[model samples]
Target: MHTTYLRDLYHLHWPKVILVMLLLSVTVQEAVSQGQGYRRKHLEFYDDKPIHYGILFAMPFTRYAIKHNEQFMTGDTAYSIKSPTKAAFRMGFTVNAFLNERFDLRTTPSVSLYEREVRYSYPSSPEKIDKRESTWIEVPLLVKYKSQRRVNNRMYMIAGITMAIETNVRRGRGGGVGTLDTKSTDFTLDYGVGFEQFFEFFKFAPELRFSHGLGNVFQPSQNSLGKGIGRLSTHTVTLYLNFE
Candidate 1:
């Protein structure tokens, strides 16, 4: 009777003892592996340089933000106006000046091609499109704020101002009868967020940025197309791919 009772107790508790032993083994293995495996950081001293250069490629979606006058509400010709979104491409080079571990002063000079449009709808006719095409030379001075680096990545934020000059302006032949002229020089406020990914030989960063024109680009002309518009400013969203 005693041996039979002891055997029954062993059978009942053996499963629980085996489960506990398995769990403890797994926990010890994980702790040991974590303590042994250490990640090697990529480009461990990249930001230690005082200055670095990079090339940039970007795609920009642009629009004309218009402020209309009273004529738009009570106009004889065009009762409505709209500026459609257009996309363009740009290329540039970066010049960076490192101030500290967290901050840097930078500039990128780029050239972009733009095709902007304004559409007018009349009570009596189909829509008229006013198309203007030009090339822009832009220089942006920016301040960059960087986060603590991970193993192979870092995050950053940038804010700055841009100076742009319009060149090679042309009115589309398929456009409306008159032209809506814009000023050559403009200024914009730019802000963006980016991430830097490191590799063995170089670093690549991807950024999304926004730009708002500080000055009006519209050149006031006594034309039927822009008669209802008082101000035209530029708005842009760009995706930048950078290589260093």
Candidate 2:
């Protein structure tokens, strides 16, 4: 059943997955064929510039990393907690400042829209699902380390910290009577690896990044539902497409 559910989820996002795979395949082929010296390199002097600018579009799958309190074991046997992940979209602007030949400082400001659900299952009662929708404005400061450029392709890694402010914190009560409150702001540490492919007109980078919240986002309230959950933190995996 778990496998079937995961398969269905993948099918729902097959278009995005296929597009990423195609980009990767094309980049690899271009890199390999360049060794035969059949094609001239594009943007040969692109990196020599002191500053570069670009825009990025990303798809992120986000979830909550839940920590349970002692009440979970001693509380009502009918209560259980389950959190599920959901996919979302983000668009941003990227500014890169060349610090050296192989290192760069980058800042990306983006807005994210996503939804998350926390479900409570009860044997004697109907299941309850609490849905939280948020709109976040996030700014990430990253340091990118690049390998030596080979022909028109290069590989790089980036690590950074992001500060995000939640603009909307609406909660929907579904089969549950209480509200789940979250903090207005959150901080996260992020890291990722990417391949950069340079073309005549621009540079294209496809990256896979992971982010973990540094602080607990759960805001305790008087509600029983809030008391049941001990701590909640954000976790995300993002696929990014950047054009420079």
lDDT of 1 at 128: 84
Inter-residue clash pairs, candidate 1: none
Per-residue alpha-carbon lDDT of candidate 1 for residues 1-244, written as tens digits (9 for 90 to 100): 0022354355335434543554464456446646766766678888889999989998887779888888877763676676766778999999889999899999989999888888877778987888868899999999999988766667789999999987775544224437777788999999987777788888988777889999988776666677788899998878788988
- Each candidate's root-mean-square deviation in Å? 20.0, 4.0
Q: Name every residue pair that clashes in candidate 2.
A: none
- Listed per model in order, the count of residue pairs whose N, CA or C atoms clash below 3 Å is 0, 0
Q: Write the per-residue lDDT of candidate 2 for residues 1-244, one digit (tens) a residue.
A: 0112474366346545645785677577766776687667899998789999999999888888878788776773536676676889999999999999889999989999888777777778887877778789999999999999877878899999999998865544322446677788999999988888889899999888889999999886656776667899998888889999
Model 2 global lDDT (CA atoms, 0 to 1): 0.82
In model 2, which runs have C-alpha deviations exceeding 4 angstroms? Answer: 1-27, 34-36, 76-78, 170-177
> Candidate 1 versus the native: TM-score?
0.80
lDDT of each: 0.79, 0.82
Off by over 4 Å in 1: 1-37, 170-177
The top-ranked prediction according to TM-score is 2
